[model samples]
Structures are given as C-alpha cells and as structure tokens.
Target: MPDTTLSNCVRDAATQAAGLPRRRSVPVSLIAAVAALGGLLFGYDTGIISAALLFIGDTFALDDTVKQIVTAAIVAGALVGCLAAGP
Candidate 1:
C-alpha cells in the first residue's frame, strides 16, 4: 500500500496548484457616489413634477379631485417600484 502521509502531501500540493481564483471587489467610494447620484436624480425628478403639477392643472382645468388622483398615481407607482425591489 502507498504511504498515507505521502498521498496526503500530494493531494495538498495538487489543491495549492489549482487554487481558487481571486475575486475583484468594487470600491466603496464608487458605490457611495453611484447611490448618491441615483438619489439626487430621483429627488430632482420628483421636485420637477411637483412644480409642474400646478401648470398642468391650470392648462387642463383639472378640479381638486383630479389633481389628487394624479398625485396619488405618482405615489402608487413609487410604492409598486419599492415592492418590486425586495431585500
């Protein structure tokens, strides 16, 4: 029979030679910047829409009920998106 210690050493050496590949990691600063930019854009878009709501109501002669519905639609869309992006 082959020597047990010698066989073990050969297996360990083979494993070392076939070592797992190293993984590349994303930088924290880059991730933080991307997240910040996304937040900025979302806030900007919401603000612009809110500001334009007045003009839209005036141009379309929308009543208070219709205006509320339009605002609710935006909130509903955001809720759906939040739900879809689960943790």
Candidate 2:
C-alpha cells in the first residue's frame, strides 16, 4: 500500500518535471553549473588533506588525537567556506 503511494508520487513528480517548458533554460543551466562547481571546490578542499595529512602530521610531529584535530579542522574550514559563500 505504501509502495503504491510512493510510486504514484514519484510518477507525478516525473510527469511534472517532464512537462515543464525549457525555453529559458540557460539561466537554469548556469545555476546548475555554479552549484556543480561549488561541489567540485568542496570536494577538492576536502580531499586535499588526504595527500597532505601525513606531511602535516610528520611536519608537526602530531600525536593521534592531534592528528584527528588537524584533519577535522580541514572539514571545519570547508564548512566555514560554504557558510561564508552561503546558499
């Protein structure tokens, strides 16, 4: 019963999405591209620590807890970057 209702909702949403006119799609495309680029930047920033973490720890001679703290700081910076950029 729930599955049927869910399927109907999905079908309705798909129909609505498909029925929309795309004549003024350039703005939409630009928005999507910007959003995707933001994601890429976020991914790049997040992944950078993977390459530099050992160097960061070794350079700083950090312990396990400190290493976790350093790694978490990168994620925190990403969050701050996103917040600064805003939605």
Tell me each candidate's TM-score: 0.52, 0.63
Best by TM-score: 2
Model 2 stretches astray by more than 4 angstroms? 1-24
Q: Which pairs of residues clash in candidate 2, taking residues 3 or more apart in a chain or in different chains?
A: none
User: For candidate 1, lDDT tens digit of each residue in 17-50?
Assistant: 8894433356977888888997897788778777
lDDT of 2 by residue, 1-87 (tens): 454688677776777889953244789899999989988987897688777887978888878898788788888987797799886
Off by over 4 Å in 1: 1-26
**Overall lDDT per candidate, in order of appearance:** 0.80, 0.80
